[model samples]
Each structure stands twice: as structure tokens, then as C-alpha cells.
Target: MFRISSVCLCLFASLAIADESSKPGRLTVAQKNGWATYDTELKKKEDAVNKACGSAVKSSYDRSTYPAFDPMKDRTQSACQMAVGTLVEVCRTPDGKAAVKEAVTKTVCRLSTEGTKVSLDGSVLTIHIDPEKSSIVGKEPGSYSWKSALEEVL
Candidate 1:
């Protein structure tokens, strides 16, 4: 009876340790800084893409009548394609590429606690919040609001 009790206690202790180890911990100072840097870089990229897309739309319409034209109506599939193309180009640089990769990895790490999965295809980023639901960013043209999505997730 004494040996059986000891074995059971050991198993219980191991299980507790395993569970604790699986839990996500707080980010370190360096990790926080890295995330901030990534956020800044992403913001810059978004601004650039938005500017380009805005210009494209503005140029497509007559200047005098532009005010009457609804911009939302212009945000079609082609506009999204252009935005994605611009995003792909912007991240083609070595520094931009590294920043984007690090951001995505960090986001995945942070969301792992909720069993979230993130995937990127071109500029369209998808965050699988759960098995039944997901949130997407950069999928819509003129809507490069990734920061908002990150805020919602965090």
C-alpha cells in the first residue's frame, strides 16, 4: 500500500508540472520591444499600401466627379489584387521580410493559448480564432487594418 501511494503521488506531481509548462508565460522586455518594432514596421507598410490604392482609385475617376463617387464601390477584387501586390513588394526587402516573419511568429505564439492558428497568403492574413470561427485582415481592398485585428486578438 505504501509503494502504490508513492507512485500515485509521483504521477500527480508530474501531471501538474506538465500542465504548468504548457501554459503561456508573459513576454520578456526584449520580446515586447520586438513586437513594438514589428508593429511600427507594419503600420508603415499599411500606410504605403493605402496611399497607393487611394491614388489608384482617385486616378480612375474624374476629379470633378470623384467627390460624388463612393470609394467603397471602387474597392473591388482588382483593388484587392493591387493592394496584395503592393504588400508583396513592400515586404520583399530583407528588413521588411524579417519584420513581417517575426510579427507573424510572435502573433502565433501569443494566440497559441487560445488554440489559434495564423496563416498568410500574399497580403491576406487569416487568424483562426477557433475550429468554428476565424478572423481575416488585409483581405479586403483599402482595408489594411491589421493593427485593429491584433488588438482584438490580444
Candidate 2:
């Protein structure tokens, strides 16, 4: 009888959690505008980095060879690292730095509504979103804004 009661309680608790998560997440007008701006800036930066890296890789390959140069072997990983380096370089500039700070601040403010914790140790930046008490982790090196913000918050 006790075992059956415990099982029912566990089931009810799980259902309640699921119901909460199923509800849509809402953002204010300011947050929506901020997110749009961030999205556009992010896309522009990504395109620049990708174009630079792609050109470098293509030029490095010998297209004249009989066997078409296959750059896919571990190229993606290397390209990604190069892109990160490029992003870091961009972040070092005054304008880039300011953009990053503004983006981070806006993002943190939006996420704060759902409870967010941000931390940066060396190159790794960890963000914990407490909507459902789940954590998302990402690592990037030499992001000054990340370091500064983390220091200020934590």
C-alpha cells in the first residue's frame, strides 16, 4: 500500500513538472527588440568569419590536382578553431567589444526573468538557466566581454 502511494506521488510530481515546461516562454517588447538586434549582429559576424576561413582553406588546397582535393578530413574542426580565433580578434577591437558587452547585457537581462547564472573561468563561459532548472554550457576563448561581465556578476 505504501509503495503504491509513493509511485502515485512520483507520477503526479513528474506530470506537474511537464505541464509547467509545456507552457510557452514570453519575452517583453524590449527583450524582443534586443534579441532581433543581437541576431542580426551575430549573423553578420558569423558570415565574415566563415568567409575568411573558407577562402583560406580553399586557397590552401590544390584545385589543379587530378584527384579533387578533399578538405573534409578534420577540416571542419580546424576551421572552427580558426573561426573562434577570428571572433576573439574581432572582440579585441573597441567597437566589437562594446557590441559584445551590449549583447551579453541584454541577453542576461532577458534570461534573468527566468533566473540565469553566468560564470566565466578562463575561456569557458557557463550559463545556467533555471526555468526548469536546466543548465547549458558553452566554451569560447579570449572573449573579454565574457570575462568582464562574469567578474561583475559573480
Candidate 3:
């Protein structure tokens, strides 16, 4: 009975971890937007790869020396290119572009950065909220503002 209980507990623990891992990373509204951008880029690259290497290209290979060439290798490399390390979305600067520029220089990141657009840093891809451009206006009354959501996070 003891052995069976221990095994069941272990199995449940592993299952829980697997389930959590399968879920998308938790993010603020701005972060979700940034992640969507990255996702779009990934899809674009995947589409390009599929177009270029979805089918094996004809190669001149001697029957005796080399019977086959692997187009899968090229396809695999292109598919791998779709992966970007991590994405961070910085809080929007409501004060305007000048404030955003100043904040970018002062903001510190815990992680190392390959590219930074604004407050986001220490990741392969980073984006900061651009108040003027990165907004959605709705004709209907009482639309939620991304800036307000971002302010709470920041």
C-alpha cells in the first residue's frame, strides 16, 4: 500500500509540472502584445521555411558514392530559426517620447539583452510601449485602455 501511494504521488507531481509547462507564460497586457509580435515573426519564418524547403530539392548525387541528400537538414535549420530567446514588454511612458527616451537609458534589466527597443531588455527580443502609436481606439463606449493596464504592471 505504501509503495503504491508513493508511486501515485510521484506520478501526480510529474503530471502537474507537465501541465504547467504546457501553458503559455504569464504576462501583462503589454507583454502579451509583445509576445504576439514575436509569435507572428515566428510564423512568418516558418512559412518562408515551408515554402523554401517543404519538399526535397533535386540534387546531383552519384548512385554509388551518395544515393541521397537530406533536404530535411535544411528544413530543420530554418525551423530552428523561429525560436527567439525571451520577450519583455516595458511599461509605456505616458509622458511622451522624450520621457520614454530618458527612461530607456535609466531603466535597468536583470537579464542580459541582445536587443532592446525601450524598457524591455536582457532578452533576445524586447519592446517598450510607444504611447502615441501603440494604442487601440474604439468607437464603442468604455473601451479598455492598454496604458492603464500597463501602468498597473509597471
Each prediction's number of clashing residue pairs: 0, 0, 2
Please state the error at residue 63 of candidate 3 in Å.
45
To one decimal, what is the Cα RMSD in angstroms of model 1 from the true structure?
Answer: 18.2
List runs of model 2 lying over 4 Å from the truth: 1-25, 55-85, 88-154
Off by over 4 Å in 3: 1-26, 55-154
Q: How many clashes does the backbone of model 1 have?
A: 0
Candidate 1: the clashing residue pairs are none
lDDT of 2 by residue, 1-154 (tens): 9999999999999999999876654555754554455445444544553343231111121112212212232122232223233434445556654443433221111122243345544433333333333232223333333234343432
Sorted by TM-score (best first), the order is: 1, 2, 3
The whole-model C-alpha lDDT of candidate 3 against the native structure comes to 0.32
TM-scores of the candidates in the order shown = 0.37, 0.26, 0.22
How would you encode candidate 1's per-residue C-alpha lDDT over 1-154 as one tens digit per residue?
A: 9999999999999999999876655655754554455445444544554453331111111122122223333222232233233433545556554445443321111121243333454433433332222233433334333343332332
| Residue 80 shift from truth in candidate 3, angstroms | 7.8
Answer with 1 or 2, whichever has the higher TM-score.
1
How much lDDT does each candidate structure score?
0.38, 0.38, 0.32
By the lDDT metric, which is better: model 2 or model 3? Answer: 2
